[model samples]
Target chain A: MEKGLIAIAAALAVMTGMVTGIGEASVARQAVESIGKNPDAADKIRSMAILGAAISETCAIYGMLVAFLIIFVLGA
Target chain B: MRAVFELQGTVFYIIAVCLAILVFLIILNMKLKKFDPLDEPKGLVLMAMMGVNFIENMLKKDTNKEMTEKLGPYLAFLFIYIFIANISGLFGLTPPTSNYSVTLTLAAITCIMIEYYSIKYNGVKSYVKKLFEPLAPFVVINIISKVGTLLSLSLRLFGNIIAGSILMSVVYQLLARVSALIPVIGKFNFVGVIVCSVLHMYFDLFAGAMQTYLFGTLTVAFISNELPEEAKGK
Candidate 1:
């Protein structure tokens, strides 16, 4: 059971990283495209991108917490 | 396990450091030719917003004047700083505002500042009298309402950020398992990323900014209400 849980935790970490990376890429793309079309809106787009990326990372944090709980609390 | 700083002490330090950096940056930027020359840079613009908020209360204005003018910038700054702090969870840094002590101290400072200015602008007698007006024997209720501001502000900020962080972690873990079972679609984890990013932006950044603005505006309203009719120039 412990082995299984550890495997699960590892998987979760990877997923979190993947999700965060994808989210960041999309936001970056959108930001760049928007800036290219309207240089004047670059500041707004940058702020939005930052906000979008920060929000996107929430899932990763959730995954980490669960992995910790499983390891420490469940002793898995 | 050893306490480096008592929780409250740590909170005080965080607030002090944040405020000190804000003040120092403001003063330094003011002297820099580039900052003052044409249009202000984005970083300095954010800082200036904060500076305006800090000085908002100090500016004397009639009661009829819209309170936003005095409090808007400060509210904007509070939101920006608090939102940034809360979102620091993404980078694995413990959000200072996540701790109750930090929020409580911030609320307390705002409360004290509002009350102090109220009394200063209006003599003690009038200040006390204003509390009893439009209704009598409800002075205690009014005082409690004032104190309640701290509780509401602290809890709102703390609850939102904590919930967002906790939820994000949980979702990531669950999704990871699902993705593993379906290997073909696993290569594109774009959906998870987009969902998480949007949620963080809304809950942490957007909401956080709005909350900060509300808190600052509320403080201005609370203090302005205490000013005497003459002081209001009405």
Candidate 2:
């Protein structure tokens, strides 16, 4: 029962990726829209978008770390 | 039972670092004859010059001539070392950047550089005063945020690389199992060979380059923000 609960907790923890995916999707969408408006600035906009998306990815990573800890440390 | 002293990827990381240093040493040790403006640089000279020029141009955006002169080589080295380390997985080696300790130390160095430049440019008095900001109580929060940058920087690189590795391994395992269903060819992972190359292109090459560029850019941004606009030559 405890192991099952731990599995559930890990699953919950990994749900943070969903949040990150949504955030990154919006970031890419805006970047593409801006590039369409001003193609000359696409390079700068693309870099900025990638940076922002990468930074936002830290949240999901933290969640993943927690999930791994729960499964490996606790489940063990 | 899991070993308490996990030494995962340390050896591979060291190998990657040595490889990066050796490459740089070779490039640095090369003898070059002075050439006319019309003469084109060839081979290693072209690569070395282009790398230096690229790093300098990137630094020029955020720093003054003196700052760029000081930081250009260091940032170039950091970028190359990270790019090499992150992509070492392609050569059947564990990528050192995926290791938390390795990424943490790298981020700590960047954090130290940020603080060093902040103190150097803005003076010790202003540095301490900036921590207090609008109120004395804010110092705790300020310190936390400063430390947060260190953790975030390290964790970002570590997480990205590790995630890519984890996903690739899972994919490979799945591919092997799927390929095993075949009758005769089940002996070999034919599916993995075909699919993994595409996956490696994104997971290793693209991600490695992007992370290296982001790390360099963020390091420059953080450090340069501490300097005055005049000092930054912008």
Best by DockQ: 2
Report lDDT (CA) for all predictions: 0.64, 0.86
Best candidate according to lDDT: 2
Lowest summed lDDT over 10 consecutive residues: which window, candidate 1 chain A?
A: A53-62
Q: Model 1, which residues run further than 4 Å from truth?
A: A1-76, B1-31, B35-80, B131-136, B182-191
Residue B107 error, candidate 2, Å:
0.4
Clashing pairs in 1: A55-B200, A56-B196, A56-B197, A58-B168, A61-B169, A62-B168, A62-B169, A62-B170, A63-B169, B53-B74
DockQ of each: 0.03, 0.48
Candidate 1 chain B minimal-lDDT segment of 10 residues? B57-66
Cα lDDT of model 2 by residue, B1-234, tens digit? 988886665775677667777976675655344434477878767777898988888788778888898888789878888998888889877888988888999999999999999999899999999999989999999999898789878887888899899999999999999999999988699999899999999999999998898899889878877897778764
Best by TM-score: 2
Task: For each candidate in turn, give its C-alpha RMSD to the true structure in angstroms.
Answer: 12.9, 3.2
Candidate 1, B-chain TM: 0.67
Error of 1 at B77 (Å): 6.1
